[model samples]
Target: MQLVSEFRPKTGDATLDGLLEDAMVRFLSRRPADRQDALEKLWDAFERVKTLEGSNKSVAVPILLGNAALGSDPFRELLTDEFHLLTRVGNNFTIRHHEIGKTPPPSDHARDYLFVRLASVVAVVLRHTGRMA
Candidate 1:
């Protein structure tokens, strides 16, 4: 799974950029735990990236997505679905949290799949929103 040759997202925020960088480095490692940590950092960045313009998540996310979607209703709906689906995955898995009964990725490939999916979404958002070059 080729996530990217270099994962540099110019989100106009240093902390979020650093988090995204760290996640890429950790995700590139061979260890499974590092991959999980990567997911955690990535999801954290994803959550924060939405708030780059405003504080309210509900308001900011839709606006951020609208920026990315660029007046395409179908694409906007797709982005909306992807945002929720990825959020759910992060929440239900052990990658982002370690509460009671969280489930780890089913396998190494599954871990890779999850990482690639979310990372790609993040890249798209940054690109379409003029945050990344």
Candidate 2:
């Protein structure tokens, strides 16, 4: 699977940007034979982007995604539902929950698909937030 060389979203938050870059590095590395590890890292990156403007508050993903500070473009408006769905997918299948034997693990293809989705979301968020020119 092809991976982005860097996950630099540039949300004006240094820590969050660093976290995303780290996650991207892990996802691109070949050491993670188990797709779960890459998914977990990508999930962490997603959560960090979501909470970028929350000041560490326990805000819902939808609320974070809808924040006016992000932008009011039509694309941002359209992304609201997509963000929620991604959150649900992450919660259901990844390490966000301890389902262990209860939930089936994601296949390599599924993991690659999710990675692309997440990369798109992060890129959109950065562009909308005026972080990306």
Candidate 3:
């Protein structure tokens, strides 16, 4: 099992924090075959935070992932590309919006990678928003 010691989000918002914690636990405990669902839940957690902050009204993913608030323009562009790729992977392969018969599920490594990346982004958002000390 991969250890996710750094997958911590201190958003100070009960709902968002709870979701992040639940997703972390699910990712840590679930088997590889069951991890795709966990990844989707993790992405949902991030989305929930974005919605809670009222930052995703016009955007698909969180504005933090694409906005200048994250960093410089080049860095924001990179993060935005990464976020979009992650979203596409979730929608195309994972259980997020894929039909069982139409799309192939992601492998264990892919799921793990997605979880880690999402966790990192969530942590960044928390830190950026002064929710984490």
What are the models' TM-scores?
0.93, 0.71, 0.72
Where is model 1 poorest over a 10-residue stretch in terms of lDDT? 1-10
Q: How many residue pairs clash in each candidate?
A: 0, 0, 0
**Model 1 regions lying over 4 Å from their true place:** 1-3
The lDDT of each candidate is 0.87, 0.66, 0.64
The per-residue C-alpha lDDT of model 3 at residue 119 equals 71
Residue 129 local lDDT, model 3: 62
How far out, in Å, is residue 34 in model 3? 5.1
Worst 10 residues of 2 by lDDT: 60-69
lDDT of 3 by residue, 10-123 (tens): 666787777667777777775874466567777777667666456554563445455424557776676667666766766776356767654654467766776788777666
Report the poorest 10 consecutive residues by lDDT, candidate 3.
Answer: 60-69
Q: Rank the candidate models, highest TM-score first.
A: 1, 3, 2
Per-residue lDDT, model 2, residue 69, is: 30
State, as a TM-score between 0 and 1, how close model 1 is to the true structure: 0.93
The better candidate by lDDT, 1 or 2, is 1
Q: lDDT tens digits, residues 1-133, model 1? A: 4546566678779999999999999988999889888888988998898797798989999998998998999999999999999888888998778899999888989988988998999998898888877
Whole-model lDDT, candidate 2? 0.66
Candidate 2 per-residue lDDT, tens place, 62-88, comes to: 555565335565655677767778778
